[model samples]
Target chain A: MPNTFAVPDYFVSPTLLTRARTIAQEHASLAKRLATDYDVSAARRLGELQSTSTAVREYDEAHSALEELQSLLTSTDQELRELAEEDIQPTRDRIEQASAALKSSLVPVHPFAHLPCLVEIRPGAGGDEAAIFAGDLVRMYKGYCARVGLRSTQLKYDTADEPTHVQEAVLEVDSPGSYGMLRCEAGVHRVQRVPATESKGRTHTSAASVLVLPSIPTEGGGDMGEASFDDPKSDYYVDPKEVKLEVMRAGGAGGQHVNKTESAVRLTHLPTNIVVAMQDSRSQLANREKAWQLLRSRIAQLRREEREEEIAKLRRGAGAGKVGRENKVRTYNWGQQRVSDHRSGLDVRNLDNVMEGGEALERIMQSVRTWMAEQEVLSLVAEEENSQAQKK
Target chain B: MPRLAPSLLRQARAIDVLLPPLLPACRDLRSAENELRWLKDHAIKTGRQCGLAHSDASLKRLVARRARGEPIQYILGTEYFGDLELKCQPGVLIPRQETAASVTHLAQQLSKKRKGRPSDLHILDLCSGSGCIPLLFHHEFYAQPGNEHCKLHMVGADISVQALELARRNQKSQIAAQSKRVTAQTTSLAAMRFLHADVLLSEAANAIHAPIGVVEALQQLTNTRPTPAYEVLISNPPYISSQAFRTTTARSVRNFEPKLALVPDNPSSAPSALDGDVFYPRLLALADQLRTEIILFEVADIDQAQRVATLLARQSTWRTVEIWRDEPGATSDEADHVLLDGGESVPVRGAGNGRSVFAYRGAAAAWLQ
Candidate 1:
């Protein structure tokens, strides 16, 4: 590939540059509107676009600095050329940083990115071994949360007949901005290992699917603008009529007659057929509240993905060979003591470190996050390119 | 109760050693596992607070108590009612979720109708076991940002001294918890009180006639000059019929919970009263004497709710009577009206089997909207 001075390896493409500039313009207009009217949603949108605008300004300065360095590089004087040579590499680095920032800033932030998240893990394939792998994944995520200093609570942990096997589990990472951090972990995770239950030494393949959903704020919504449950237009809003609640009180009379400790609560979104059952807490009220919160998060995530899919369809081939929830995004090979992320194509030899949610797991997660950001940027560029083509 | 299968016990054993003990009370492997997990978590939490040895001892004691079919609320020492957690004792009736849901719905309605207006509102809770109804109502009502300026005088009355004591304790703790969260608004938690009163004798009692009447008790507790008229009268009195108590009531409830809070004490005295319908007539008479604007009576089921609603309607004091279900906020696809014994029909609200009978006077009919 021929190296171009204008478009470096980390530099933003023409389409992405225009996208960033447009976002900056939008931010400016929103700020002006907010100054006069003080609309809440508009102000929120302005806050969201703040980083992109800042990135655009930084990229422009870096571009100007590079142009100045380029002029100095073409100077006749040997001293000026040498001086420029020294600053040229650092200027290129600055450009690279600015462009990278600008590109990511152009990628739309997830609506629930600032909220805490729930990580749901369920066995996917290979029966009892898969259940055991699911248990491993649960511990791995829990360990990762601990190492990263994120407060995590096991919202629901159901165990199979086997002590070591996990029927299903939900781990709540109770910290803001966790959705942004752990959303990349949502997909099938395959493990190649010899089962403890296996009589023979033959290696077996098993899988566990991980789902990351934003945990809606219980009381004060914090910064969760339209995601408020009361807002009918909000993705979090499920019409009360659309949901069927089942309290696991034994058949017959309720109230004081039943001192039954079965405080399980199940909520099924009728339209979506998404059922969320919670029995963790002894209080039925608490369980119901938690069930609703989980149900809303799941519905919100589903709605967001559906909208994204529609947009992705419009910009087809932009996310070519992209790993979805159905695809195995990662694999932990116990035989080779390796952990690999398929999307980012990163492989590490330290299996124990990954299982411990150590530096190796962080590296893999970071790589996947970067890969996801790149995908978003590519699709954004494709969208802009198509719109521009239509203008022609 | 049906005997637990050996397989279920085996599964419970697989989950945890403590789980099999909870299987008796929990009645299933899943809930048993959940209870065990909660108990273990509670133990660990207590271990952090106190020593690990103390935690283990308490966990074992709690598991043993639960195995004997004691309510977890009693073992845990607290029960959540709406947003507030009330102290639960053995003799005091544990706050039921259906009651919480009804109270929450009523509070929401009252606050919504009030619309940030500062006004004196008095609520009378008859048979207020654990003082869950009034405290929950206060918590749910005052939680709305603008409602802090509103003057709330709530009195929870119960026949049992233990129930009254528990109710007062719940009120004090809740008031302390709420005072910390009180904004710039001057909210008074002092107005809420609990008193001893036999609501069964409410028919013959009046402010002047009987010193222990519901009205006189309200006056003594609230100390309002000229005796304030209650805006809302709410109760979750014992409504289960004696036969139903023997046949339909859960064994755990029969074993552990207080019968004083489950079945009305006497059914022979009132000629017109069925065993379960005994409390309604007395509560209605009390409501009429107090001139309470709204009344919410928690019933055992639809049949009981109908009986109460019919009784309230026959008095001619209430303008409209409605039946509410387990979840009063939930939407239902069923018919909005349930036909009474007479040709007249009453509007029904929410979902599940009818849980509460709601009736309001003409003055407070607007609040129902």
Candidate 2:
């Protein structure tokens, strides 16, 4: 693997660090209580003594209580540590961006904060090779998920016919900081090798694109102003006359009905010509509610796209063509056995090890943390300069 | 239950008389009464059975044993398992009621599904601790009053020689009981055999070899086959995780069990080994090779069950998997703890949620298609 980048070190704010230290101290106290008061020590002693029946029963109960307490403490400690580590920066540009946000009095928002992430992998220009590469990418992400204790659920997939494997697959991974870690996975991944189906020893190049979308929060409206919801501006509605509601027997992935009755409902929005389907509910009403939420998210996404276009048109006069353009995040060269992330300018030489899902990814996560810290510091400098100018 | 013997009842009354003045812990009247009754009966019965005369010394010793928390069954030297009396020892695991229920369920299913006479049946019991499973099957089907034509061929395998010996003794006792019941017209025949083999070990290397005694016994029972395969395979293997062992109460780990019978024999030294639950993968591999029609294995909990089911579903061999929990008797507190894949809680019918058993059947290609 390539050597990880070592950016300038930054310390978290003293207030946050102190809070984390207090939390850790509280956890130590709780652990001591669990070991002493819960009879964990007593249980170990009784096991040695081969004690009376009452003693044995007491020991079992005490041990279980201690185990539960320990698990709770570990989870709490992890949360505290993440919060403490939130104050670092490694780059001047990111620091300046943070300073600007603070100057504008805008609340800081994580790109994928508090939302389940949707990861999409699709074959690009490379035909069968791209599809096969996409399949490999899914496995890599799944392995990464296992390492991080994230819960991954396969949302949907389209398998290639006979000769090739998976053409496209989508997964929803739920965990703390999952989207922030996986956002770098977006863009095209390239693979070069002789295809197994190809008889000749000629090398072929294939490409697959990954799209990571933070799940739209249904409860918290995301930048959707009042105008988007008002009925006046080209209102779109599902025509009841043209719409059809179908209930069918639904089963798990293997396609056999787990239940005898047709409780699943599929709703087709007539005006936008969009179909929303849901089946994992016991009652029809529950299924309908799920379908409606999905429909709302779809409509919101369309409205957001239109709003972005209008904003871009207005920004054109400002002559800031480079503004708002996201970077080409990462590239994997299979033949050279190397992976390069343009954002951090870090290169990992062992592509196989990185693809196998190991510590190589942690290097990237640490760099992101450092970059975020740098952004904060630059913002602080900009604010200081602006205040001085105002005073003069 | 029968009332206590008169002499035993008198001894109990005496204990109750002395307890109030001596120990304040025994001040509770109902608790004192219960202690007295338990001590009196336990002393009288175990003393007589162990060939000790009905003397004051014997009574005191028996009472001391009871107070020390030794299981009553161990003091008695025998416990009833099905229709046979099994020799109970300190090292051997006790024959649980839930296991008995599992066996009964399997037998009922087999009887309902199978056609023709219940003869020519082949059964294999792995991890056959005291051979109670095969012996019970024999007693139920072969030694029954009217079931004469049933020809049962049973092979019980365990890794421990001591356990296998105890199993043999239990089998012999059952056979002796059968011969006594048989009249001049009917002839009693041997139907069960015991073997000592470590199923976890690879057969290529003789690292953990099957005991010669067990091998010979199996050959005799099978009439010359070195290895006897069966249609029905059942095992209650060690499924506890190493992490569970570390945090588990000493009552489970140190006092009541043997480590060899509880923990996996070997764990791969890999980073992912912590996540890899061992027994399921090995058991499934064995099932694939054996191609047994029916296989049942006990697991720790519902999470293990789901993971096992997932592993089996990935393979081509097994088609149907169903989880079976032991129904706790009427006296047990009713609480459901089994969790389904979709995060719904379902009732596990055993003593605890952890003791539930799972059953899987090999799927035919026609069924899949």
Candidate 3:
């Protein structure tokens, strides 16, 4: 609803672009300072300054070339304009590539950017239909994952009391660095449709809340990537003393009552009051491990948001509709047979196709990615502003 | 993705035996080319037996056998399951892709269970034709870096002495041809004990046609006076209907595979499913006696799964009975759903088309009587 899917040139914050010149200037001064001092502190400062300087130079070179080529497009001379037109595509590509490299160097890395992701979806409001729509959301994401070549493992899926419909589900995207791409998918999604079970053909509004968290690397088991879960400095690390563990019989659907023993493990983080229940595993130990993982990820995400609060303005009003957590980010309306992503304001008319994660879904995801990158640029811009203010 | 080479295509054309189509079925052109490399290796190794070393003849013979409905694994001598290559021979059933999938699913479940547990574990493989299940588990358990010290004492019980012998050889060969993935671990292969006992009879030795002195045989293999309590019981027990085997089963399987491995030998008084699901009830009873935590069985299909679920429900010994799909990574939601108390329906959560049933004892919640 914010409709912030600006053009590529304007998407990056102006402050970051201006800060490139400043970073270049600082690097020059730092190099001189290092040469004069030749101390450990100056040498370390130089080490950090070196990459920043290179990235700034790279961004400036591409940005300037793009600006020059763009100006030539309006040249009076016909031959020059034709030359500009011919070179425009290549020059734009170079700028985009350089900016990507520059952005990676400039922006502070999200602590969990390289970790895998877990997506938990639950019905928020709208009763039985909401649960049914939640199931649909699960299918949509699963389809999207398939199209994107991201492997999703169903960690837990609970059907509604009706037995035929799904109520809540958790799917783990196992691909490394999936968290960076999927993190912004958290928040609320709204749907408006006539309930199939309704006899009166009344349109009912429903919502599903999606929470995306970074999955901890399974200690010593599971997939290849080995990530630390015990290091205090690591974002994913959780203090065992702060957690309260409980094991009970795994409940809900088919997994229930199958184990004559108590196999389900639930972890409550005393500090955060965050509760995570895991019973999919038959062994209590397995359940405990999974529950601990879920708890760690939740706490880590909360920690990230606490840090993100300082630059929360970078994400200001990205979602327009004030329906649920951080505004309803997307709406799927069956009456209009359309899916509208609020941040990008991308309206794809084919609801079925969007739900299937077809071309329509791809278009929305790509635009959202662009918007997220712009937000990162804005955050970098804010960081530069803070440092500049301090210096002044 | 390489296209089939023109020369290879020409060579396939020249060869009279029907190996061309079979090669591509294994993989794309690259797979066919790889098989060609294996054929060449076989050819260069021996020239005496049936002129195997005379390159072209060896390829022709290999193809001819496959073309005549012999399983490619049998002819190839090894089937790769997980990271291990199980030696396949006649009489013993070849390790199927479905079987490999079942092993993978079971191992993942067990790996989670093995967290901070005892290093030494015992497993029983009923109707373990090729000893693939235990051997595959042996490899999977030691696959991780820190679990190198984990030891698995595996028992493979089958009535056929031929199958038992092949199973033993598979155990030796799999241990010898250690997978590079598991070389990070120094754990030896599971200590194997091949039991020549029929599960149907009261006495283990009496179950078999020939008296192999069951207790003596088991002792000789295990070197343990009394068998330890098995933690896991796994089987790919035969569940095919007589009619399906006679009519619906694949021509190659019907023609070549041992009938003893595919069908219940004497089925007139068979206990369940009206066809031959006698093994399901027997295995459940056996599981009750063993008090095994996990029981995994490969079924014929969803229909057989339904029949087995009914048996588990009737037996009322276990807490949860789940139908698992055999295809890797496929969601349990896509698999068949079984109705529980209060008319709740839930899919057996795991990968594949739900061709297997994974039942473990949960807090003894009573099933519908």
Best candidate, lDDT: 1
lDDT of 3 at A56: 71
Q: Which ten residues in a row have the lowest lDDT in candidate 3 chain A?
A: A252-261
TM of each candidate vs. truth: 0.80, 0.39, 0.47
Query: Over the full model, what C-alpha lDDT does candidate 2 score relative to the true structure?
Result: 0.53
Q: Candidate 3 A-chain TM?
A: 0.77
Least well predicted 10-residue stretch by lDDT in candidate 2 chain B = B21-30
Model 3, A1-392: lDDT tens digits are: 12122356524455665776566688798788877777787677667667667877776676677778778877999999999889877866776666676676666566667878999898988888888888888888899889889999888776633433566698999898888877767778999999988899999998989889888777733442334666676667788888876544212211100111234567899988999887664334566777877788778778777766655654443321221256678899999998888877788898998888677887877777666665666656666777677899
CAPRI-style class, candidate 3: incorrect
Which residue pairs show backbone clashes in model 1? Answer: none
TM-score of 3: 0.47
Candidate 2 chain A: worst 10 consecutive residues by lDDT? A252-261
lDDT of 1 at A378: 85
Please provide, for model 3 over B1-369, each residue's C-alpha lDDT reduced to its tens digit, 9 standing for 90 to 100: 246666665555444234366554333333343454455555566555555435677667776675455666667676655456667777777666556657776666655544545566667888888888888777676664455666777788988888889888887776567655543233446347778766665455544456454334555575887644666789877666676676556655666677778777664655434565767777877776666766888887666777777777776656667777655334435645767543545456554344678776642122111
- Tens digit of per-residue lDDT, candidate 2, span B1-369: 134345543443454443332122232333334344445566777678888777466646644553454544455455555445677676765554445546755665555433443346567787788777777766555434445654666788887878888888887776666656553212323646677666665444344444433334455666875455465778777665666555442332334445565666676663332332566676666555555566767665556656665665566455455555543321246444445565534445543333434444543222222
Q: Each candidate: fraction of true contacts kept?
A: 0.65, 0.00, 0.00
